[model samples]
Target: MKRYWKYIRPYLGAFILAPILMLTEVFGEILLPRLTSMIINNGVLERNEAYIVKMGIIMVLIAVIMAIGGIGAAYYSAKASISFSTDLRKDVFHKVQEFSFKNIDDFSTGSLVTRLTNDIQQIQNVVMLTLRMMFRAPGMLIGGLIMAYLMNRQLVSILLVVIPVLVILIAIILVVAFPRFEVMQKKIDRLNSGVQEALTNVRVIKSFVRETHEEEKFKTTNRDLKEGSLNAMKVVITAMPLMMLMMNITTIAVVWYGGNLIIAGRMPVGDLTAFTIYIVQILMSLMMLSMVFLQASRAMASLKRVKEVLDTEIDLTDEQASEKSAQIAAGKVEFKNVCFQYTKGTEDLVLDHINFTANPGETIGIIGATGSGKTSLVQLIPRLYDADEGEVLVDGINVKDYSIRNLREGVGMVLQKNVLFSGTIEENLRWGNETAGMDEIILMSESAQAHGFITSFKDGYDTDLGQGGSNVSGGQKQRLCIARTLLKKPKILILDDSTSAVDTATEARIRQSFTTTLKNTTKFIIAQRIGSVEYADKIIVLDEGKIAGIGTHQELMETCEAYQEIYYSQKDREKEAGA
Candidate 1:
């Protein structure tokens, strides 16, 4: 509630004015029935022509005023609601941006998208309804009942039965509708997830000829969404018909009783006519009130979902760092007695009892069999995931001590899966250092061995990439990513099998450039191919999340069994290829 007020406070004027203006419309509406009763009783029945003209003109003027008020109400309500949702959407998006990997893992991609869009939209709708109806509905109900009393006091008895029944029906509908709406929102998340996955991996789906499989998955989610929506709306749908039935019954009863009163000369015909319309207006206002409550109930479900994201405690934050000004320099990295798990309080550790040190300017190679915790080890350096047991240090300071931005800015990493946004090639490369000039951009591209193919494109550096760089080959994508990271010129660099798609000749050229141009940068090379990391200053071989060996090529060849096995297997493969 407090968090939402921040957004509301800015547009408080519009919020307050909307309902206030609506009262003018409601006031005019209430007076119309009373004015009609007078026009009939004093003018038509008594045969007074000027009196009829005067009252009719007054009614028209009141209607004109009512229309102006309604237009003003609508304008303010729309302004308040749109502005409120815009700010709320922005904050929700910012909060998601601040979420740690673990916090993000707790909510799926599709769920976040729904919360940012559909959930906030629901809240906005409620705000618009509330702003318009807050005063209008109640004003009409109270004014209508009062005028009805003046017209015929005996007619008020009918409301005692009708109001309570409609209120009870509305309450029952809301109670059932709220939970179903929540379930419906979750179904929307599934639908969105299915669609996003299919579109993003459409290439994979086509290559494997699994379009039918994807369609089936979409159909299941789509069907679930349809059923969920119907369940939610079903109760809300019942409200209108039940209210209309009661409305008709109450109208008939009022006319039946009031008609008798007119025949007995206890009430005037104009009074009976006015009384019937007042009953309808009163019932209509109740219906409007019920609609407002129903919408509010649905918006509450969305609010809860939105709150989950806003209230999420990001497990990773640098708020308590001792050295706020700490920055990474010299690039010395060490892991001491480090233990980790993707899930905490579990015996199944991803990396166990890990211990290693890489001095500044040394090229450290990390080779491991699949699922040997290669990526997990390097991720700790940037504090992507905190160590469950021990500390990860950079330049002698705990990685946690340095601010995340400071530590990350000094360490550049190219993960196994390369990602590129939809933009020109030059715009993509500038992500490393936005201030970098064209000369620096070309220099890094040459070092990554990407300049050759990049220039061959018609637009060269200005060539626009498709989403996720789909237009480029796998090898070209890797080289572009390499160049992008290189432009950072960080003290520490990690290339996690980033060159796997590039041929050995180009890969070697990139590595060679590192020694000459980036001699001072400590580089961590993670690869499956032995030759990729064979000539490093130090090679660390991992097996089942443990360091099997840590030494240069010849040193590991003699001392480590795991290292010997890997070397012989690769040498045999090379021999076969040679033949």
Candidate 2:
């Protein structure tokens, strides 16, 4: 919560001005009843119509002043609150972007989304409400009580009893309800996670005919959320009725005591009337305070949740050491005894003492069974994840020494799952090179074998794509992603099973075209298919995170049993399909 003040600090003038205006409005409201007392006791009792009319005009003037002040206060409060939330949201988004893969994995995507949207919205509403009501409520309550006592101290005795009872009740309610609100937020995160998962895998649910099962799962989570919300509401509902009951009792006592006093000639009728109004004002003000506190309690919970994300220190930072004057020649990579594991204090390493190097213009193919760490190995070259034990060098300098922007710009990587943003085809291509011209786009698209289909669209380069490229086929999305990478013309290109969705003929055409156009770029291709790796300059076979074989196709066929088994198994599948 303190960290969030950086955003609020700029709005300090508005924050102060809003409450001051609100206090003036509250002062006007408090003074109105006293003016009424004077009108009733002096004018009506003395039979002075002129005095009554004059006081009446003064009352109307006070109301007008309050109205104007209220509006001004509301305007400033709204402006400050909105600006505060906008700045806070921007800061949160930027912090999330800076988080490393390890930090992201600790908080799942659905939970992070909930924090960014729902949690922040909760805090924003509370800030706006607090600025509007904080000064007005307290001042009205205290000022009304002081005025009521000064008007007639005899009737004020009831308030001494009433205020304490209400305070105790509110205190108990807050204590019980505060913890429940935190739990309710966690439940919402779980519900959001469940819904996000079901939506993302709707295709899988339909293909497996498991719609009923998915529906049941969603129902269970929805019920859990409902129950949590209902329980919290129940606490609030129970406490509110008790508060009302206390206020009602105080009202009855005021009327009872004041009536007795009036009958005995101990109090003036107008004075007693004003006293009752002041007591009601005090009670109402306390109720408003309780309401504000309730919201503040929930906002406190939300504030803590939002602060957790902002407080997370970035795990990776660029080295402050002076730059060494060594130059890394283009397309050269070396991993010296590199090892990694996702978690610390774990005996199992994902990649073990791995040593490998690829020279300029060479095509290195990585083939492995599932979970053999092929993707993880390539991720190190771009410094996506630092190695646990040894150095990963691109050119000649350790990757850790390079700035993140410099490191990523030199490497073009297409992940196994291709993703496209919502934009025109040309806008998406510009992500690779912002200044790429139409001719450059066409050349790269054709080289990646994507131009023919792209030009088939009604708008070609101007064709608008849906989010995640949902409007395009899987193979087409892969091709566009490949073309986008090709436009970068990076020194090292990494394709992580990027062509898996394309037909064999199209894959062969793309590969052949790439080989000719990307002659100066080193390519690292990871594939499950034997055919994909067969054309590589050299192939490395990984078995259980260890390199079992490293050689060309002909060399591995005679010497590596693991390579032979994989090759023959893929051959048998091809033969069966052909037959």
Highest-scoring model, lDDT:
1
* Tens digits of per-residue lDDT for model 1, 126-166: 99999999988888899998988777778898998789888
List runs of model 2 lying over 4 Å from the truth: 319-329
TM-score of 2: 0.96
CA displacement after TM-score superposition, residue 367 of candidate 2 (Å) = 0.3
Q: Which stretch of 10 consecutive residues in model 2 shows the poorest summed lDDT?
A: 320-329
lDDT string, candidate 2, 405-475, tens digits: 67788899999889899999999988889999889999999988889989999999999997778788899
lDDT, candidate 1, at 442: 99
Candidate lDDT scores, in order, read 0.93, 0.87
